[model samples]
Target chain A: MEDKVKIIEIKKSVFAANEKTADDLREELKQKGVFLLNVMSSPGSGKTTTLVELINALKDKIKIAVMEADIDSDVDALTVAKKTGVQSIQLHTGGMCHLDAEMTSQGLNGLSNLDDLDLVILENVGNLVCPAEFDTGAVTSLTILSVPEGDDKPLKYPLMYQVCSLVVINKIDVLPYFTFDVAKCKENIKMRNPNAEVIEISALKKEGIDKLADWVLKQVKNWKENK
Target chain B: MHELGIVFHIIKQVEEVANKNSVKEVTKVVLEIGEVSGVVPKYLHDCWKWAVENRSEHMKNCALEVISLKATSYCKDCERMYDTVKSGRICPYCQSKNTYLVTGNEVSIKHIEVKDEN
Candidate 1:
């Protein structure tokens, strides 16, 4: 007796399903008049600090919520809730490195007043490599690079820079101690993605926080009116 | 690790395909992985072996076949192509950094083989 085997052709990208889910999630958010922002950065890059500053600045003007994603612990969510006094939830990736579209939708479900919120900020896992690969159905993606992380990060991690529309250079106050060249960093970023907007800020000292706040408000307005 | 996540995604997709076709058991899956897609084949295989048995319903003990594609970058200045693995973003031929990836960085499912009762 001969063995019978059947072959089926299914030529699709591994990210195809996630992409479709992300697109559908985006549509749902747009209909609800909610703007989702995904923030990606390396660990200890002041992502929480920047978020606290930005949220404090915008909390009065609009209804906002924060989703803090990490492998373990709920420290970030606690910090944001304490500082900003807004709705915050923690999402555990169950040892996974990044959050995909499905996980993001689950996180959104955890929010109590998602429909009334004008903006939902997702502080993605602290890794720059993995988070950039998966889209979390965000209206805009921002990557934060600190001055101490060196200016050549864009050259090393091209995909992260290419996917993010805005690049925030945090810890600019410590620039004198570090040898990070802002001009060279901008040039390197332009080499990878010509249209990426860059902003410099010191989240701890509250320098340039107003500009960042303005940028966020503009994004929310544009997302609501244009799209 | 991301490899584990990727394995889960693959299992989910294959399970959907299996149910759509009313497949009882899936024996093999073939994937096309690029040389510089950032996915390590060893890790992927290890994850696949563990996930198929634990996470998947119909793809238990499924064999994974990986085909690697060479990475190449096209130089806009010199109008020539170079091996991406050897010469990263900078083109080795013209020493110009105005180059983009032509191929590679792909992770796709090509086909699957299953058992037939007939």
Candidate 2:
């Protein structure tokens, strides 16, 4: 007599619920011609500071909204809201290192007037690993790497580099103090994402902000054209 | 870190399978992980160490097996598949730009082994 154990078969994605919600949210955003930019980066990598510059540059011309994901405080959400004067919501993920499309969809739900907006930015939790897996149905996923974090970032974390549409190198003004090689970094980025744009800037000093803004506007324009 | 979350998902699936089959216990689990999936086998084991222990009283002694899937590239020109190390986007046969991925990008529980009582 053999030991009796149960054997059953099931094939399903762990992200099934989140993926479905994200798809519907994406469809809703598409109908309104609103583009959601899923932004990801390591903690204190200047993702928020970059957002500040971006909002400061485009707020008057574009109806931009922000969904800031953080584990504890609403500081980032407040910072971006103060700069853009647009609708900003802070999503407390508690301790999750990533943001799935379900949280993002719920965050976007707070803004009922999304139909009138041109852009929606969902600031993902500060982690390179988990966030790359969640699609969120964002048209484009953007990542930030500050100069202090070393230029070897892309090679160390390839998936984030591979899937990202843009790699924004923030805090270039401090490049003189750091040993970061811009060329090698660009090469690494291009290796993984040859088609993705590389935007170099110092988000804090406001230097190169215009170029970054231009790139965002260009992508948004391209999205509108295709839509 | 996300591995535990994945294990939780797997546990739920395991429970469903057990309920449907009207079985007593789960003895083994088989998983195929892709290199591109960015999942470290060691980390997965560490996470599963805790998840499986907590999920089931019977599964406390069950085994988790991981099979690595090698990433391969596809050449559109030659309509052939090759390993990722030797090729990325270029077709080694024709050196053409038409290339795509053929395999090695997946994470699935392929099979589970168990004993059945009469």
Highest-scoring model, DockQ:
1
**Per-candidate clash tally:** 0, 0
lDDT of each: 0.92, 0.80
User: Candidate 1: TM of chain A?
Assistant: 0.97
CAPRI-style grade of the A/B interface in model 2: acceptable
Compose the digit string of candidate 2's lDDT tens values, residues A1-227: 54766454544454555578778878878888999999999898999889988988988878899999888899988888887787888998767777777778778888768889999988999988888877787888899999999999987787788788889999999999999999999987875566768889998899889998888898889999987
**Minimal lDDT window, size 10, model 1 chain A:** A187-196
Find the 10 residues in a row with the least total lDDT in model 2 chain A: A6-15
Clashes of 2: 0
| Model 1 TM-score (B-chain only) | 0.93
Docking class of 1: medium
What does chain B score (TM) in every candidate? Answer: 0.93, 0.82
For model 1 the TM-score comes to 0.90
| TM-score to native of every candidate shown | 0.90, 0.86
